[model samples]
Target: MNKQKIAVLGPGSWGTALSQVLNDNGHEVRIWGNVPEQIDEINQFHTNKRYFKDIVLDPAIKAYKELSEALDGVDAVLLVVPTKVMRLVAKQVAETLDHKVVVMHASKGLEPESHKRLSTVLEEEIPAALRSEVVVVSGPSHAEETIIRDLTLISAASKDMETAQYVQTLFSNHYFRLYTNNDVIGVETAGALKNIIAVGAGALHGLGYGDNAKAAIIARGLTEITRLGVEMGANPLTYSGLSGVGDLIVTGTSVHSRNWRAGDQLGRGEKLEDIERNMGMVIEGISTTKVAYELAQELGVYMPITQAIYSVIYQGASIEEAIKHIMSSEFRQENEWS
Candidate 1:
């Protein structure tokens, strides 16, 4: 593979982890962040102490405070920012972009109010003239393990096969692997919706529920996710892939997941505002829950798991009450694909 200069926007854990991967692949990585202290730390100490305390980053992974300077002469742009700021950052990238580049986003969430996927948001902000197909790189990978060079595999999904294959080649290494898929809609939907189930799983754990409850959440949550995904014209088989069931299992079961952590706090009777304040990172699942709830209602899709989590998060309903409601509801045959 030819060495390329790539710009990575957002210096958060995921962004920093991916930058390390690109650097490992012998590519010139320019990481852009808004925080001056983070930029200085990456430059001076070769570490992002805020996110990864002990791991040292490569010296070749240069950090930049200026957006334009980072985007300068880059071959591809990997967006790892929060879903809330995706539009703003993509717009800024569009305005600063002087040439076309392969644009990919690792964000997982639907746009609030618009109810559009992150790729749709990216497409709206970044013009077709300024970029290639909007690729969504998502799956069960977590940044904490990824930074330590643990084995991780994820999907590189796009409508364009060449672009997806290019991204797969760009990020693949001994420790990290990428599988290319053409189901952009399924990948994005599964990636985003799984977070909500993860929140529910974490909440169940916090409530002292055992493995049985959590397992039920995972299985039923996938059903709800696939239901909505299919309603939105996604391939049903995609739900069984890395970005769907794989992501659901990892995020819902692991303590490393931000959405799960937030849900755990919620289960312990903590306020959403307090949890957000303490986490100091964007919990994409919180907003994703709202969007999924609204979208399910709009589409007339039956999403009991999403609805239960939504009630707890939005309606201020008690977690126990929500679970009770779910358990006591009318019995139905399993494996109903509707």
Candidate 2:
């Protein structure tokens, strides 16, 4: 593989892990973050203690406080920030771009206000002249596991196959493998919607429900995700691929999942504000649950799992009551269309 210079915008755990991957691939990586102290720690000590704890980052990975410096002359950019601030960061990157660069984002979650996918937000913020087709890199991988160089498989998707392939080539390595897909809508939708289900699964675990209950959540939650994704113009088959079922399985079952952790806290009777404060990082599913609930209603999609999670988070519904309602709801054929 030809060596490339890549700018990683966001020095969070995901961003740091991806930067290490790129560095290991013999690429030059520059990471940018808003926090000066984090940047300093990364540059001086090769560690981002706030995110990765005691893990040491590759010394070759550079951290930048200035967005322009990070973007200068880079071949591509990877966005790993929270979905909530994607637009703001994209606009900043757009202003500093001097040439067209392949732009890929690994953030998962829809814009709550506009219900827009992260790629759409990037397209609106970054002019087409300065950026290639937006690619979404998503799947079952978590930063904690990825940083440890654990085996991980993910997908890089775009409407343009060549764009996806380019990203696939850029990030793939012995430990980190990537597949290319042209289903941008499906990939983005699956990546965003799975977090909602993960929250439900975590809630199930917190409620002292056994593996059987968690399994049920995963199955029903996937149905709800597929219904909404299909309504949003995503290919139905995409939900079965790495971005869909694969992602849902990992996020729902792993303690590494921030959404699942938040949900678990909620199940234990913690308030949303307290959860967020303790998380220190963004709990994307909380906002995503609200968005998915609203979208399901607007699109006339039936999503009981999503609704239950939303009620728990927003309507102050008791966890036991929500699960009871789901269990008592009328049953339909397993393959019944929503």
The estimated TM-scores of all candidates read 0.99, 0.98
Residue 314 CA displacement from its true place in model 2, Å = 0.8
lDDT of 1 at 272: 88
How much lDDT does candidate 2 score?
0.92
* Model 1 CA RMSD to the hidden true structure, in angstroms: 0.8
Can you write out model 1's per-residue Cα lDDT over 117-219, one digit (the tens) per residue? 8999989989999999989999998999999999999999999999999999999999999999999999999999999999999999888889999999999
CA deviation > 4 Å runs, candidate 2: none
RMSD of each: 0.8, 0.9
Model 2, 156-249: lDDT tens digits are 9998888889889988989999999888899999999999999999888887889999889998889989999999999999899999999999
Clashing pairs in 1: none
lDDT of 1: 0.94
